[model samples]
Target: MSSTPKRVLVVEDETEIRELIALHLRREGYLVDDLGTGDLARTQLSKQPYDMVIVDWMLPGLSGLELTRWIRTELKQLQLPILFVTAKTDPEHVAAGLDAGADDYLAKPFDTLVLMARVNALMRRKSWMDSFNVESEQSPHAHILIGELKLDRDAYEVYLRDEKLDLTKSEFKLLEALMMSQGKVLTRKTLIELIQGDGVNVVGRTVDTHVFGLRKKLKDHSELIETIRGVGYRVKLLNG
Candidate 1:
């Protein structure tokens, strides 16, 4: 682990729950910051970087799902892990929370021990991502600019026609892979590895879901991503 203690943001409207979570995290040597509303969490996020964030489902302003999407899409903090802690424990709600970009979900009444385990696991993931970024930075493909598309690997931001596009972590990874391939067709299996890492059990159709999201955000620039008839997708060659 890095010498720096992991930083965590806990967003919960319930004061007692927020403080309790913060206390546990602090005892585990994490630096924890707590907020009472989703809007406040957004403000705090813009001002500082966090290793992980724990968000409640119901917040005063944006709601947990909306805030999670904002963190992924607008803030582009795919590297930052999010754990959802909410009372909504139904299957559909769990699916929705995961789909909204939560790395893990804990229902209300969850044992604090379970919460700690999830937190530790997410932190391990964070460490791996940090190491991966360091190695990737050594490559020439770290930064790309062609036509109006610009991708800043260091900043985790993607811009099309000078406008930044809202993207989830998967969508961002998928786009990065295609653009870096430089017009080469990437099969679904290849793309899955690029986005989800080797040995990850993600089916190829998961790539399709992410592509659909990327295209939606790309809007008029959606044509830049070309789908092959029977294989996968690629980016059309474009001149800067």
Candidate 2:
């Protein structure tokens, strides 16, 4: 079977902004679809699958937050990237957007460069999702079993032995990096660079803070993650 060309749906009430994104994305070699309202977006999404959805926070009918919740709750298996582009940059708004299932966001009025970066990030995430095993009723779950610590990829969840560990986004990425290395010590610089992506401003100490939080959250299994004194950290393997 032929692979379908990756398509993105741009849903925004503002005509200029909608066209602007569609134009830029099409120029970047992606098949782009444009819709003016949240209702139209819902209709198109129901009819066909999109690799990613760029949505405006406010709409005449259904709001972006509402749409995100619907997508997350109703379409559990469709892990399409949701990117919010809007003027609302308040911390509460950003948090609400993320909590509502937006994979990433761009605050307006945003630079075209920044928007493109976010778009690329979303597309990269979509590519990752496409490569994931999605044939079965259940998604393939990956477990990096390092001794008592476990990192679950399918659920984006983690645990220590049988006990659950709640980790923030950064903390989880840090743990995943260490667990994947499996006894190999990963430097703080490497961990931050891997998790923060290319352009984000992240310092070495930020990694330390995330590691500290991760260690605290892991509780009794904290020993599973070892600090290498002058180096960084490692997650000890289960069998070795």
For all predicted structures, in order, the TM-scores are 0.60, 0.76
lDDT of each: 0.80, 0.74
Which candidate leads the pack in TM-score? 2
Ten residues in sequence with the least summed lDDT for candidate 2: 130-139
Candidate 1, position 87, lDDT = 97
**Quick one: RMSD of model 2?**
4.6
Task: Give the per-residue lDDT of model 1 (tens digit) for 1-240.
Answer: 467898999999999999999999999999999999999999999999988999999999799999999998899776678889999989888878877778777889878997897788668756644554565544533667757778877566799876888776667777876776667898987675545421124578888888988888888878989999789999999855
Clashes of 1: 0
lDDT of 1 at 114: 79
- Model 1 ranges off by over 4 Å: 137-240
Model 2, residue pairs in steric clash? 147-238
The digit string of per-residue lDDT tens for model 2 on 19-101 reads: 99999888777799999888888888888888888899998899988888877777653357788998887888988887777
